[model samples]
Target: MKQLIIITFFLMSSVVLVAQPTFDLGIKAGINNSKVTFRASEYNSESIVKAHFGAFGRLGWGRIYVQPEAYFSSKGGEVFEEGTPSERAGRFDYNNIDIPVLLGVKVINGGMANVRVMAGPVFSVMTSNKIDGNDLLNKQYYEDNYFGYQYGIGVDVSNFFIDARMEHGGELYKHPTLDIDGKNQTFMITVGFKIL
Candidate 1:
């Protein structure tokens, strides 16, 4: 990933001979239907309020382009522990901040709209380690410090954009048979702006 970013930077410096780098800023918000699972573990699904509101920029030279974005996002995972009649089950919630950089290839373009495919790594940090009035359950999970990878496509029409992508922690946990291997898979949609 470092190599890819470096190469892209050099390419952008040279590509500006025709058209200089251009940028756009916007805000995005959406719902996250998340699941913490594995090939072995039990199913734990959570739907929390997930959204991103920040600034994004695009650098383009004719049809070939690259977009880099930095944003603050409230991301979390939830699981239902146990339940009974007239009693609600416990919940697991984690809130985080996500920073993503995307590299894209434009397949088609129009005067008022454009379509591109993107893939990149998201660097995330845990901002809140406690959830649902409990601090013990969320500690070890929050200690994980690593970059997750995401890939998706985008459709930009005038000032509106829609994105769909998948993300994973890429590691297994210590819970063994109940270990959560597939962690933090987020499906999101947010409205953005083209503040050129």
Candidate 2:
């Protein structure tokens, strides 16, 4: 019975040593170019650059992993009236808290570097908004909460990583009395360091 107990203990130890999963906790900051595209032909949209900062945690087994991130982001765009007497332009700015949960696969897993692809859904809650140059626009024209999706590729070398992603979403703003409907599209690039 003593020999059998020793054998079981060794087997369990070996299993534990062989099945180690990876975990990473990190902080990241990035820039994004965002645009709100309107469906009405009379309005033209242009992208605006903004900053985002956040923290992230990743857990993985083998080449498969899940990452969750929370970040503060400012997003919006500039709109121009195409056929107006003065060609009026308006700017829309929104501050938000964004949370994304992603599933990723490491396509190239090496000893020193790795490349991965990830896709996920994101939830955004608007904390505030600033509208300029348009008297008809207000907070009521924008959404307080919205859902979006993100897909991206990343490269990790040692403890540092970089990611490039594209985000798209449903309607972000709709005017109650006008034919104005807008959706958000953004491209983002970020760099991060792993703390764990």
Candidate 3:
């Protein structure tokens, strides 16, 4: 019995020592109900659905993990103004391209499931029509180089995951042309296979 106990302990320690660290690579995509909110009395909120696609990777130790991901995102919105500069009603459109680098951590060790939170910086470019030649729609787009912030939470159950994230972009100068930024938030539910 004494010899069996010693051998068992040695095997467990060897397993721990030999279990090399690991990482996962996969894909994520989902829907974003996006809108632009203006600070001016002449404008109202416009919502649009833009698609996103990207790859992700995770690297760390034990149940604690550090994940960094990057993806391409389309964003924009539309609204009808009650009054026109020269007429009765006016129409406006806006579009942008965004790239976000996110850092995340898992808060639960749910065997095959866990909850995660991620945050990072977003780079955005105004990619469409301009209002008053000023791109009032982009009034929020062009002001800063580091145009936005990224933060989100979701659950991962082995082969599936879901989360909602908020981002804030554009400079509220000259025009209150800031996007719901994060308010144009995303709710993503994805199915993936772990590839290392």
Candidate 4:
């Protein structure tokens, strides 16, 4: 029994020493096409194109993983209203800090490449907002923080990855008197390289 116990302990230690660690750090850059949707109005805004860049850290154990990222993103859209013999149009702009935490699983691990599916919640804080060339920060007309979610599929090849995702904002602005209830929706594609 004593000899068996010693052998078991030795085997466990050897397994621990030989196992590989499952952590990676990466950098990513992407483009986003974003729009604002109103709940009760037909005045839909046009989609705006923007760029996003960020760094992410991923931790994985076998086929399951979690990835958290911090990035800079640009958002907002143009609103146009048709009036009598005329048209009133303006644009809204915003710069934001976006953070997303995603849980994922590797569905196919093919030696040099892998396929993954992920979904998670995102939190964003507006750094600056402008409408029709007027700053919303000084005007105090809108909120600064927002919540959203994203789901996507990704392909990883060695140290590089590509991801395509759809994201939607939960609540934008709601004013019953003004009839302004809107949310944001975005489509994005990103490419990344693992650094660690």
lDDT values, one for every candidate: 0.61, 0.89, 0.59, 0.81
Model 4 TM-score on a 0 to 1 scale? 0.81
Clashing pairs in 4: none
Per-residue lDDT of 68 in model 3: 63
Predicted candidate 4, C-alpha RMSD = 4.9
The root-mean-square deviation over C-alpha atoms between each candidate and the true structure, in angstroms, is 7.6, 4.9, 7.0, 4.9
TM-score of 2: 0.86
Better of 1 and 3 by lDDT: 1
TM of each candidate vs. truth: 0.71, 0.86, 0.63, 0.81
Q: Residues 1-196, candidate 3, lDDT per residue (tens digit)?
A: 9999999999988688558555788887776666555555666545667766677777755655656666666654555453544333223334455666677777786768988887777776555534442233434443333366778887888867776888776542233333333223333433444555
Give candidate 1 misplaced runs (Cα > 4 Å): 1-19, 38-40, 80-89, 133-140, 170-182
Model 4, residue 19: distance off in Å is 8.0
- Candidate number that wins on TM-score, 2 or 4: 2
Off by over 4 Å in 2: 1-19, 85-87
Best by TM-score: 2
Question: Per-residue lDDT for 6-99 in model 4, tens only?
Answer: 9999998768755854899989999998877766554547788988898999998777889999999888776654341223556667777889
Clashing pairs in 2: none
